[model samples]
Target: MYCKNCGSALDNNAAVCIHCGVPNGHGERFCSNCGAEVAPGAAVCMACGYSLSAQKVAAPGAKSKMTAGLLGIFLGAFGVHNFYLGYKGKAIAQLLITLLSCFMLSEVSAIWGLIEGIMLLSGSINTDADGNPLGD
Candidate 1:
């Protein structure tokens, strides 16, 4: 096999690159299939036709749907849940609408956040800011 981090040859069983100390498929410097240097953000290697980007792999510490849902339900007026989910813009808007207006229209923001919370718990809003699916 090859080390995607450094384009160095690797034992098939190796978990990380000896040269770069990065886990397999962690870096974008070289094509893992052919050891050709590729653009940092290039999707595929022109020389060897190897796809440089890793396929969507589930992460070990994906966010929790339940936690996000509860946060949205309880503290959505402050946009806490949206911030936790990485929807910074939405979070700021909700927070401002409630805080800046001195709670005059907090119900509007609260209901909006409550619905989002329900959506999150119901699997309708499943992805995080990076588009990674939330964990159960």
Candidate 2:
């Protein structure tokens, strides 16, 4: 393996880079697969075919999973929980489904939101729209 932080080669079992002191899998400067310098925000390495989509993990989101799940369960027909979770597109779709149909189709969106709520509470849907892990 290679140190993503420093482009230095590392032992497969090493926990940190001996040259840079960075913990394994902690940096974005270089590809861990090929040790090639990576561009900022690049999803894949140009030098190698290794996937880099999951390179960085943002800090846990401030939105609470309980809060979101509860909102989805209670006011999911209006997609209030999705709005709070930054899932504006899904929220708008749900809201529009209820509004455009004059509540006739509200149950569809309601069921959708309810399922999402349950998933959230069950840890099946743990990330926000930004892909940040939800806070407990």
Candidate 3:
């Protein structure tokens, strides 16, 4: 193997580059398959025909669409759905709005959350704050 960041040879089991201190598969400057220099953001390596346009892998613990939607529908006034979706600001807003108004404005927050929940269930809001797709 080779370090894509520095074009230096790497052990087969190595996880990082000894020369540049970059992790394996972490750069676009060189071909990992052939250790040849490649243009930045190039889809294919000209020297070895290696494909570089790999799809981004989703995180293992991605949020669930059903859970988020249900939370939004049931506890939207408290911003539970937003919190689960990593939308801290929106969650805090909803929570504060409901709390500050002593439940007088809870209906407004609930409506907002219900709309967001519907959007999530309908696939309009598919991704989380980190851009990871919500799970089934």
Runs with alpha carbons beyond 4 Å of true place in candidate 2: 1-61
- Please give, for residues 1-136, the per-residue lDDT of candidate 2 as tens digits: 7898899999999998999999998888898899999986566687996766554443654678899999999889999999999999999999999999999999999999999998888666767888776767
- Candidate 1 lDDT for residue 25: 72
**lDDT, model 3:** 0.85
* lDDT, candidate 3, 1-136, per-residue tens: 7788899999988888889989877888988889999888565678988765443333678798899999999999999999999999999999999999999999999999999998888666777877787775
| lDDT score at residue 129, model 3, on the 0-100 scale | 79
List per-prediction Cα lDDT, in the order shown. 0.83, 0.85, 0.85
Give the higher-lDDT candidate: 1 or 3: 3
Q: Give the clash count for each candidate.
A: 0, 0, 0
Q: What's the true lDDT of residue 28 in model 3?
A: 82
Query: How far is each candidate from the true structure, as Cα RMSD in Å?
Result: 8.6, 8.0, 9.0
lDDT score at residue 131, model 1, on the 0-100 scale: 87
Worst 10 residues of 3 by lDDT: 51-60
Q: Rank the candidates by lDDT, best first.
A: 3, 2, 1
